[model samples]
Target: MKALFIGGTGIISSAITRQLSETDGCELYLLNRGNRNESLPANVKVLQADINDESQVAKLIEDLSFDVVADFIAFRPEQLERDYRLFHGKTKQFIFISSASAYQKPLSDYRVTESTPLANPYWEYSRNKIACEEYLIKQYREQGFPITIVRPSHTYDERSIPLGVHGSKGSWQVARRMLANKPVIIHGDGTSLWTMTHNRDFAKGFIGLMGNIHAIGEAVQITSDETVTWNQIYAAIADALGVKLQAVHVSSEFLAACSKEDYTGGLIGDKANSVVFDNAKLKRLVPDFVASTRFDQGVKQTVAHVLAHPECQTEDPEFDIWCDKVIDALQGAIASVKGR
Candidate 1:
């Protein structure tokens, strides 16, 4: 299989890159700015060009055609428009990495399938993804663009731990608080269920879709069937850190009001809601694909990787301070009510 991945070295795409590179007959090519090409496999060809600059990217891949082209960085519909121009007839399959968050906000049902409605008014990111999906589907239906939409939900790798409530920098701060024995904030009583897929496991399902005739013209969401509460997710982090869980539950509304971050969208619109994805569609398309990583096991590997790698241990003091403030204010409110 000859495949090209745009913006390949990310939390999700990096794993795919690695897996495909090691495959017996896979010819993998990566197109990006080439800043994060340090640890990629030597067999992989690197095309160093910014995808935003269409002319530059066009010239770079003028003579090269791929069996599959997956775009990991396209967030807007205009970007999809550019991709259509660049790879209209050049590839047999075009996979757009959409988000499962594109599923309806406050979903009518907790279970999600490929047929789930694409509507997310609460998050501009999800809404934009929906638009991108719409554009690609139109292209496929009207002009046979050969597009396959793959939606990933809360995928994590060894580089970063996944969490419900965290600041802009990422979930490292939340893990750091766990290590330091500081209280970590969990939104919406921590009982709302969520699913986190290990990126390595996500890679298996994604690779199955590449150059797959069945996946073309279809939107499939690839996620683990395992669903755990936000509390259980955080507890796994604490267990990985070898510390007692010091969790402070806060209302999603209050957290959104207190923080400058997009808690309203990231929390209420997405994470605060209980979501269990039905992977029957993925299974029918890719019979061998199964997400084998449990939350506890994956979180342990992630926490261990973060601890061993200094680069992943980025300290977000500002977010840490903000967490303290949120926890303190909640405590004060509770105390005041008790005194009254």
Candidate 2:
């Protein structure tokens, strides 16, 4: 079968392309902005086009068609709409990559199925993804556009890092800090439960679901079955690195008091005790889906990747600023409380 993958330059999509090329009887075509094509397979065809531009995308699709279209980076509704306009009738199936954040629930719920309500309209990223999913489902039911949605949990490849106090990056950052023998920074008690999935496993499961007719019009949560707390995650990383887990725990009340002036920093305190998602539906859909890499194993792989490729280790400036803000808030709270 012929497959056209959008945003093929990313780490996740690159793995998918490699897997598809190795599989017999599968033809792969990558449609990217043409920025990073060095690691792509020689046998895989490349199409240079901006997916955000409707005219260029439509023109590209005028002559080319595929049995399956896997979109790895459809973050905006406009992008999804452009995809629908370009390949709605031409492609046999559309597989959209969604996030577990699309589900509005705590992590401790034990199981959040496809039936979970999506994030509220105020969350820009999750809301946009849900809107795209809703649009695709509507098209499939009314206009017969074959569509499947896959919601992956925190996916970490060897190249990823935890950046700051929040987000997937933040989690990785905490792990890195622990690995570095630095104190693990905890905003509030550090009892929040979360899960991480290796990108290669995620990509494999995603590809397996591509042409499965029964998967159409369904949202499958792709994640590891293991659930862990923030403290446990830090301890695991430290243990893997052969280091001690030294943590500086801050109270939630202190963080709340500091948040009066710095809301973003204080918000991290609340997330400390939150449970994010449950991936039971994924297990049921792909009963054979087994996560080969554990969190510690994944962390070691990530550390190796960072050590080998120094360029990928540079921290994002925005994350640095956010971290500074949180630190400042914490310091101010300590001083204020001491003065009282």
The lDDT per prediction is 0.92, 0.70
TM-score of each: 0.98, 0.84
**Tens-place lDDT digits, model 2, residues 141-208:** 99999998988766777776532144323344554555666565565676756676777788767877
Overall local distance difference test of candidate 2 = 0.70
lDDT (Cα, tens digit) per residue for candidate 1, span 1-340: 9999999999999999999988999999999998999999999999999999999999998999999999999999999999999999899999999999989888999988888888887889999999999999999999999999999999999998888888778888888888888888989789888999999999999999998899989998999989999999988889999999998999999998889999888887899889999999999999999999999999899899999998897888999999888888988988999995
Candidate 1, which ten residues in sequence have the lowest lDDT sum?
164-173
Error (Å) of candidate 2 at residue 83 is 0.9
What residue runs in model 1 are displaced by over 4 Å at the alpha carbon?
none
Q: How far is candidate 2 from the true structure (C-alpha RMSD, Å)?
A: 3.9
Task: Report how far off residue 153 is in candidate 2 (Å).
Answer: 1.4
lDDT of 1: 0.92
